[model samples]
Structures are given as structure tokens and as C-alpha cells.
Target chain A: MLHSFTIHRAAALLRAGEISATELTAAVLDRIYAVDNAVKAYLTLLPEVALAQAAAADAAIAAARAAGTLADLPILTGIPLAIKDVITVAGVRTTCGSKILESYIAPYQAAVVDRLAAAGAVILGKTNTDEFAMGSSTENSAYFTTHNPWNLDRVPGGSSGGSAAAVCADECLAALGSDTGGSVRQPAALCGVVGIKPTYGRVSRYGLVAYASSLDQIGPLAKDVTDAAILLGAVAGYDPRDSTSVDLPVPDYVGVRDQGAGDRGLHGLRIGVPREYFAPGMQAEVEGAVRAAVELMAELGAEVREVSLPHTDLALPVYYIIAPAEASANLARYDGIRYGLSAPADSLWEGYRRTRGQGFGAEVKRRIMLGTYALSAGYYDAYYLKAQQVRTLIKQDFELALQDVDVIACPTSPTTAFRIGEKVDDPLSMYLSDVFTLSLNLAGICGMSMPCGFDAAGLPIGLQLIAGAFAEATILRAAFAYEQATAWHKQKPAPG
Target chain B: MSLTIAEVEHIAELAKLGLTDAEKALYREQLSAILDYAATLQAVDTSAIPPTATGLPLRNVMREDAVRPSMPREDVLANAPDASEGYFRVRAVFESGD
Candidate 1:
């Protein structure tokens, strides 16, 4: 029962003196111990560390209340949060789901980890991800695959699969996931939870192992929109440590959400239904559910209209080129000379070769090789440069569309959670799984994936609400309205 | 364009990854297919557009040239596979093909 509480409800209980942080954390750790063997949501569970943090949070909260300074109590005090393996946690092993850093402990805290720690959030543990956050399925993880909580045989989606499954199964109050392309939203969609990928620069990328620098963002995954909004408020602010972090004020997302909307809906909101997002091969169930959701929005007093993003067809090609190009460069740092796995060799060059050759997984190697070719001499102008130009066009398409509509509505993925290993062999098919959610990252804008409906098999379908840069408030507001009107967000999975 | 095994091997080498013969062959097929799919971009008429290296239009980001607390030596060497005397040991890198 404690594990099922959202961040808001859990915080309320802690403040009301009805529950101690230590007791609440023990309940969550118990849940992880119970279901994580089948779910495999965590790479490592920091139970001793979590319990210590819980005791500290309980003590601090009690001190604040006794001093009659309850208002000074940290918002995240006692809240349990899961960190994806890709994020650095000082003094904790951060593998990035890759053997290259399998036993590597982070030397320093990531910007987000520092912010969360300052807020007194209890760090439950590190969740799994694609090795180096490359593949769309957790199958790419060097260690194991994370099964969807809905069906034990199906994938939870990835490379944030572990975080998504963790939240969906109530193993943690909420989790942090990094999105480069659809890593956050796609997995959340598949697992039937609320996931947000804030505008590219909204959250700092420092200490988030770079997959694709330009596209990477850190955001929250939660059971409901309000909890996501609350979690977002805690860690989102300009950090001078991250040069690319935008120097803009982070809004009180939870505050705006609780402020009454007179109509209990998004009145006067304009939602654009992109025709291109509903491509020919999209599953009929997904299309029907997303269409029905738009209809519900129309009934909720929001204006729905059809729009086209012509370059939508170019997104996959463009993403494949740009992301790998950046990854190839970023990942070059894992030389045997620095940190991580190193193979002894006769020469330093051979050392670099053997270390990388043995350290990386299949998908990681494929991207690196493809990227090396794309950025190589004589091919740069044709492939890499061309993809960049197309990327500009893709960003412009969203910029122009948002001028007419407040948000773009579409399905998060083309299908529900497919069986594990179904698309693992076909890299192209796996790459195409995030067709609907990729362009938002390219445009460097905000987006949220919330449960819209489910298919015949009971697997969840996600409705994606994408907004302009720094428009997380609008995205959260619209998502909250829809979430309250439907019972989907409240649905819990039968944990394995 | 189809990639030959030799070409795959060459690309793998350029990426500092030592691939086996089988890996080269497998990559030759997979990379060819991915590249062929990427060749679809050539059909778009984009001669007039400029490239976007980053999603945001970032200017030259600069800060004061000041020193800050750096990672401690022990922490920096915490995960190194080979380390000694406050430094990382590696095969000699600058022996000019002697």
C-alpha cells in the first residue's frame, strides 16, 4: 500500500506524521525485493544506503515540524526515487548498462543527483537501461532484459525500460530517466505510466553519460501527471556547471496544476493532430485509441484540428545519422587509458582497439561503426551534413505548427508493448519503434506521454502531448486534465 | 551503397574497434542496409537549407577562466583498470613505429 502511493500522497502522509520516511522506504525496498527478480528493473538496489537516507529524511522532517518550521521541510524529504543507470550517483555504481563501466562507481554526483539529494529524496537504486543507451529495447543491456509488468513475456520498452517498469510496478515512488530521442517516453508509454521529456535544455545533461549530446534531456517518470510535475519542479533549474543548460526560470509546475481550471478541462486549448504521425503500417488499435482520445479532448472543450508535418517521414533517417555521429565522438572517451574495462595489449593503439571491441555490445558497435562512416572523410557532407539540414527543417515544422496549435497530439508509439526479442534482431524495426516520439527531441521541445487507452491484449497505449520549448506547464496541464477524466493512470499492473 | 567486408573492417579500425571476421561480414550487411535506408535523404530537395548542428541556436558559451574544485586523485583513479603512483599506466603511445 505504501509503494502504491504517488509522490504527492506519500509526501502528504509524511508531513501529516502518519508515516515515517524509514517505514515508507522499507515498504518500497520490500516491493523491489518481491518483484524485481522477474521484472529485473534494477541493476543494483541500494537498500542499506536508502534506509540510511530514509532515517535522515525522517529526522530532518521531524525537526522542521517540531521547530514549527514545517514550511521549511524539503519537498522531496522521504520520497523514494529511482535513477536510471545512465545517470551518475556519487559513490554508487553507475554502469550505463554497459560492461565497459560494469563496476565503475561515479566519482562525483550529477547535477540532478545533487539537486535531488539537496531536496532530501531517498535514492532507491539504479535502474537498468540499454548498454550506453543505444537500443530501443532493454535487450541491448549487457546484463539482462526488463520484462513489461503487464505481460512477463513482453518488453517494457527502452532504453529507459527499467525506470518505466519500476514506476509501473510500484517499486519506487518515481524514477528519473534520460531521453535522447524516445528513451524516456517510449518506455513509459509501453509500461503505462506518465513520462516527460522536457525541452532539450530544461534539465541539465551534465553527468548523464552522453548518448546524443544535442538531443539528451533528463526528466521524470511517475504514476500520475501531478507527481511528474512535482518531481520536475525539484530538479529543473539552470545549472552553470552545464554550459548548455539554459538560463531560464523553472516554473512551479505543481502549483499551476493545483490552481483550479474553471472547466475541469483544457478549455480554449488547440491540439494539432498530425496526419503524418498516423502512417500506413501503424497498428489499427493504436490509431483508434489515439483518435478516440482526441475526440475526448474535443469534448473537454479543447479545439482539435488536423495538421501535417511533412518531414515526419525524414525523422528516423535524420535521427539515425545525427545521434550516432554524436555518440561515436562522445563514446571515444572510454579508451583503456581512462576509466572502465581495459584489455592489455602490445601497443596503445591495439589497447584502444581491444578495449572498445570487447567492452561494447552489438547495438553500441553498430552505431559507432555507422557514425564513424557517416563522419568520415568524403561522406560527411552527404550523410552527416545532409541529416543536419533535414534536422533544421524538422525543427521548423514544429515551430510553424505550434504557431497555429498550442500542442501536438499523437500516439507515443505505433504499437503496444511487443513480445521481448520480437524486434531485437531487426535493428531497423527497433529504430522505427519510436516513430511518433522522435521529432520532439529533434525540435528540442517539451513532451509528455500518458496512458490514453489499451489494446485488446490489455497492454497500454500512450497519447503524446508535445509543446513548444519551455512549455512543460502546458504539456503537464493538458495531460493532468485528461488523466483525471480517465481511470487509465490509476490502473496498476499485476507485478510478476 | 553496399559495404564490402574489407570496408567494414576499415571502418571498424577507424573507430578503434577490433572486429572479428564474422563481425565484419555481419556489419557489412547491416551497415549497408542502414546506409541504404539513410540514402532516402538524398531524394529531399534541400540545397538551400543550412545545417543545424545543435537543436538550439547556441552562441559561444564562455565563463571566467577560474579554477574550481577538481576530482580528487583517488576518486579519479577509482575505476581505472591500471593505475600507479597517482597516474594511469598504459602501453607506450609515442614510439614512432620503431
Candidate 2:
């Protein structure tokens, strides 16, 4: 009943009338009921709403079959999906894992949510995240922490931790998550799910609660590469509402999926192994796993080469500066005057003070203060401006490296998931968790993390695939080939 | 060591976050550690580099100044915590502070 059905298998089953959408949705819902108590992945669940959507999908499949419109369609019809807390789903609470927005119900759906609905995916629930999507671990969630499905004692990476955990636990067939500095990919790697962070502006940020505006892009968390591709095809496109949304034409992601790795799969594909990515501090097991994945690609006919992104070491400091600076500005709207939490006080200043004081979590408040200081009057030139300059150098480094390679491969995180409270008290260590993946975001490039191997403790380690801007098809093809060759992606966590 | 209480308060004001004296002391310590760590950026030598604020090279994306449709006032105020006749109601800012 709980085999890891790839998107293709699930779609075929639904189309053949062998499995009703209602039955699939009920199964996932039952799984959630069975395991969510231990994982705490979902912030909210909508069983009735999901069941209704599933029934509708079943009817649509029947009607489409009768009308002969069922052939050559988008893949994800009748699939149940979970959404990150940061992405708004109209009429659902979009807490963003913060006390500030704990009671806030989005008046409108995020553009990604609208597209997912259009693709006939059922909305199962909203998942938890770090407050304001500001932390690397879901431990910063003001309400609750999403436990790693592999081992509940460890963390599911954040701010997409809950989304990854939900998919890992089989609570949902697929989920949508946003990545800013590896938020989506890191957790996906930690939780052993396929997480894709589409190139900046590849997917619309219209209703995504802003966090590092230019750096944030919405993508998918799925059980496999095919599902991630199907979900990305549905959500990636231009949107007039978002000024930063790219007008580039969305590619036929499903076409790329069906093409698979063919004879030329990884043949002649120039894969760059960045020296900075394999620096001295990376965990030995992680380095071993990444090397094995690279070797596998080499055996598959890819020409592997050593490359240097000289400015790569600067990515972490630069990202922390710029992301927080933008977040400080983006989060300004959540003042006491708007919806969400508001603490009553005698005067307007006092009210604003009390509201914000009680609303934001400790880590969020720390980041906001840090960001505000960086962008403040006198310090702007020294901190924020310098970081921006370094960011350019980092992007240039990627551009130079891409000249020699079509794609780059590395470990998604320095190590696998750590214990829940391990890095919560140390901000620097937590920030460094995204070291390998941050450069891709700064360069506005697409990247994905696929299950490559497991740590000594049996925790999954993710191997990252990064490509130049708008090279998602190539990245997905390579990941698909690797996933097909390895059975790591198929492993599931035992229910507690 | 790097951040003073006054600097912390100044930053708190900029962020619109209120802090108690005790919290201010805590931030002074936390901010000191963070600022010291962030000091590593100073070694990068970006003296002649241009700041990159966005990925796209395009500039001047301004729209034409033309009249456009607007949302109904009722719809605009639908989600307001408190709304009065044609406006958002809020706690009075001042009763003549001077």
C-alpha cells in the first residue's frame, strides 16, 4: 500500500481507474494521522478539503477519458500535496512558522498555489518552517519543530524542513517549498527527498512571503526527480504581479522527463568539481558520498573536470548579509498595524513595540536587528555595500567556472542532519550549514539535491546538481539518470 | 565589545523592535559576537567593486504613468483589523505630544 510510486506510476494508476483519487488521498491522510504525531511536520491539515479535491479529480479523470482529453496531459493530476508555511493558500493559515502570523489566514493564494491547483493537485495542509524563513533548522519555528523522519531526534533541515519531512514521511505525494540560501535543498537532502530550487525568477514569488526577495524562488519537494519536474512545470512561469518574475518562456519540463538519460545520458556533459566545495572542513562521509556520485556520473559518460570558483568562500558571508538586509525590508510590513499578532497597549508606539516584541521569535528578532544594522545609515557602506560587491565576485566566479563545465556537483550540506538542538544556540554554525548551496542562489542559478548515500548513522546525504541559469532541464536529466541507477532515492523511513 | 547599548537601542529603533534593558544587554553580547564574525568580510577588498542588488542587468523598468483600474475600497479594507468610514482605523498616534 505504501510503495514509493513515482509520479509516472501514480498517474498511470489514477488514469487506469485502478486507484481512485479518493483512495490515494485517504491513504496519505491515514499515513499523516499515523506518523505526524512523531514528526510534527504539518502546521495544519485539511482532510475534508483534500478529500473533496480528490473526488473532483477522480470525476475529471473520468470525464477527460470520455472526452478523449486524457492523452498527453500534465502529469500531476489527482496527487495530494503539502505547502510550506511561507507560501499562502487562500483561506488557509499562512503562519510562516512565526507567532506574528500564527492566526493569519491568507486572503489570496500564492501564484504557485494557484498553479498547483490548476494542475489538479490536492492541498493536504500547510507545513512548518523557521520563523520568517530565517533559520537553517526548523527549530526556530515559534510553534513547533519538524522532526526528521529518519530519526526523530534530529532536525529536518529548514525553512522547508516541514515540507521535506512531510514528503519523507509519506504524508503527501509532493509538496511546494521556497528556497533562499538552500532552504529547500538543504532540508530535502537531510530528509532524503528530491528538492529543486529553480533559478531565480523561474517561479513567481507573488504571494510568497518575502525573505531575501531577489534570492527566494519557489520550487518543489517530491518523492522523486520526475515528480519534482512535473511540479516545477506546473508552477514556473512569468507573473505580472511580481516585478522580479522572469519573462522567459517556461520549458516543457515533462518533455525533458520523458527524454530521460538516453544513450547520451551524461555523455559529454562537463561536470565541474569545485575545489572550494570539497574544502577541508566537510564531513568525511559526506565527501565520500559526493565523490561516489561524481564517479557514478563519470561512469555514465560525463567528462568530469576540476574547476575553481575562487570567490566561493565569500558566498556564505555575502549571502548572510544580503539575505538579511532584504529580509529586514520585506518583513517591515508585519508591523502591528497589519494583520497577525498585535499586543494591546496604551499608545501607538507602545502597541507597535509590544506587538513586535511578542510576535517574533528570538532568532528572527536577532536576524532583523543584524540586518537593520547592516543597512543602517552609517554602516550601509561598510557591511551591506561590501557584501553586495562580494556577491558580484561570487557570481562572476560561477560564470567563469561554467565556461568550463555544463553542470557542477557537490554535497548538499557539510554533513547530514544534526541533532535538534545541536546548532540552535550557535548561529554561525547554523548559517554555515548552507555553505555549499548558497553560491547557486547568489548566481541566480538552478540546483537540485538527490539522495546519494547515507551517513554512518544511516542518515541520508544529498548530492547537489547545479547548472547555469535556466539549465533546469539538464540538471533534472542528470539527477534522473543518477536516481535511476541508484536505489537510495527509494528508501523510506520506518513509521514510529 | 564591538556594540554598545546605545548602538543596540539605535538598531532596535531602526528594526521597530522594542527591547527591555535586560534584552538590550543580551543583544549587546550577541551582536558583539556576530559583528566580530562578520568582520571577516573586511578582508575581501571590494574597494573598487560595484554593489550588486539584483541578478538581471536591465535597469529602468519603470512603468508609464497612466491611469489604471483600482480595487474597490471595500475590498481593500476587507482584511483590515479595524476599518472605519473609507479608512483604516488605528490607535491614535498622538494627543498633541508637544
Candidate with best lDDT: 1
TM-score of chain A of 2: 0.98
TM-score of each: 0.99, 0.97
Q: Residues A256-329, candidate 1: write the lDDT tens digits.
A: 66754666777889999999999899989999999999999888889999988989999999999999999999
Question: Fraction of true contacts reproduced, model 2?
Answer: 0.57
- After superposing candidate 1 on the true structure, give the runs of residues whose Cα lies further than 4 Å from its correct spot: none
Report how far residue B86 has shifted in candidate 1, in Å.
1.1
iRMSD per prediction, in order? 0.8, 1.5
lDDT of 1 at A389: 96
Off by over 4 Å in 2: A2-4, B62-78
Worst-scoring 10-residue span by lDDT in model 1 chain A: A255-264
Q: Which one is best on TM-score?
A: 1
lDDT of each: 0.91, 0.87
DockQ of each: 0.85, 0.64
Error of 2 at A283 (Å): 1.2
